[model samples]
Target: MTGIEAINVYCGLARLPVPALFAGRGLDPARLDHLMMTERSVGLPCEDPVSNAVNAARPVVDALSPEERDSIELLVTSSESGIDYSKSIASYVHAYLGLGRNCRVMEVKQACYAATGVLQLAAGYLASGVSPGARALVIATDVSMADARAGYAEPATGHGAAALLIGPDARVLELDPGAFGLYSYETLDSARPEPDRDIADVDASLFAYLDCLSRSFADYRSRVADADWHTTFTRLALHTPFAGLVKAGHRKLTRELTGAGPDAVAADFAERVAPSLHYPSRVGNLCSGSVYLALCSLIDHLPPGAPPQRIGLFSYGSGCASEFFSGLVGEGARQALAPARIGERLAARVPIGFDEYTDLLAGNSRCLLPVADRDIDLAPYERFLTADPGRGRLLVHRGTKNYHRTYEWV
Candidate 1:
């Protein structure tokens, strides 16, 4: 019963449509058809990794009973957009969320796969019964550094975080006990050598992702007997760098496992996989949070009294690790998720144009600066903050003073 007690996402306060970005970059318009995305979130100058992480988890924490909040014994922040080499992002997240002093706080980084790894690890801790009734929090937060320089990849990059509250309750998603598979190796498919610089060999990344999917599923099949790819799960949610990638991955998997052709694969995809792409299509890629976003999207489709569903999840990270796992969405998942208002908040996101997007890149690039002192100017983006203030208390980075990052609620 140790699994997701709750889940939520904060996809920032603004978005840039893909078409606007492509036109702004002088890229081929036809590329848009291949991406199958509508827009991407833009991390405001006042929103850094810390702010994004806190904002994402704040609502979930607020909903907890004080006793439930105090029961949170572990907090793990996963991201590649870390601000300091030595200070774990979990430190800031712990302070902002006001967790107890006895709790363990740490961070993990393995590209996009980090969050899923920590989640399983955390779930294992809960299932261990060493700390009875204890809860764990995992926040996968990252800021996008994409600009025109990234070409088409720029429009698909995204910002923000997804939060998971895991415990014995398992109200949202219940992990299938001892049913998982993993695969890992090293490759230069993608790398963020510098804080602001991202390098990716697209062909290599694609190959690695697809390769990991097959290998990991093979490992999964070994552990769980009679785990039919077509029948084991009612729905599928995979790490979505883009909607097109998920569709292609599903095609390959369907053909490999069931010998399905184009028409069958398309029909199966629409039924099992497409539901998961709704949020990812709009928010672009949230790094480690992307797959969870997909999960959220799929669960969002659960009707008022839908039956419990088994879901298959696949996560892949560059430089490179992957996992194939399964979970059951509780019958009340849709009710548990309603407070997040994912779609409503997304609709309220202020849409910025090409020129404003170009202006935003300057701020986006400096998000991970190691400078000892700096002040972020939120004055320029005041409208975004004011547009939907009632959504909830939003967190923003005020500045860094004497190497300490400061934040204020807006």
Candidate 2:
């Protein structure tokens, strides 16, 4: 079965510590302690989803040999942070990465579940025997911002991206063929129909998440009924909106799957599930990328010389689709990941004051322009400000009438 051959992730450079954010908003200090105890760290932000996807995928593509890069037959981008109403974000990413034009490019949006959907689709495409020796690139990139006016969700919101290179030969995790379960239904627990804001029924969203988790997991168990629930998978990764919710989900899963009492469940979770939370605790919610980010965390923090393990993955998106799947942690998986290096990079991020974050939210110094302006020097735009001139990458305006955009590598 086609599975992840290589994986890379990127978090925003700007870090907003939870305590500082609370202090900035004059929130109670007790709440700060609560967040800290739960291991919440900071949030990251990028100029746009395009940049996030590009930076996340660049390293993985660079690691590839020229022949492997040439063999990429599909590019599927998953996100709700889409810039254009019509054009697929995959097209921008395809050009930015200098991938061949002879590839299929499309965007998937089922809220946060889109990434899982596209991953399955990519696996099916590769397994179809339609294109021998071909590969697919699946990218999950999102930047979720909370409205300062709507203050409650700010602490839970975050931004980041993850890219997975899937093919027949996997050095990382090998996906099990016909070993996935999905449950989807229409619901308005969370939504962002408008560009600038998101609306959610918090209680309803939590209920939906747990419900979907239970149902999808049940479907998974039915498929592998003889498998031992308590000892089958060595690690559990769930879509994390916050550390607390994931804890709750773990407890629920333990009860339903293993019939373990509270004490036993807590013990099992501390050993098996907590390791997966290490990265998400620091990066906040990555929307479509959250579950995959958790998977990355699991690989990054694995112990030395540990035997291969089965990792269970649970993904849920609000408005709302869910899935449960498992992947085998093949040998040499740990050698391919550099969790310590990623931690060091995250440590070097510049922390912003509460005022700066609010200012950014307010668009005070944000580099945005009107749609009618025909003559835009894209080089100076803040979105492209971080582009390395030496790297020969530049953003070019394709057309002014519709803000048609593309990138160039000179």
- How badly does each model clash, as a count of residue pairs? 0, 0
lDDT of 2 by residue, 8-59 (tens): 7777656777777766777677754333222232322224567678777887
Most lDDT-accurate candidate: 1
- Model 2 ranges with Cα > 4 A deviation: 28-46, 364-402, 406-410
Q: Candidate 1: where is the Cα deviation over 4 Å?
A: none
Lowest summed lDDT window (length 10), candidate 2: 37-46
Model 1, TM vs. native: 0.99
After superposition of all CA atoms, the RMSD between model 1 and the true structure is: 0.8
lDDT of each: 0.92, 0.75
Candidate 1, position 58, lDDT: 94
Which pairs clash in model 2? none
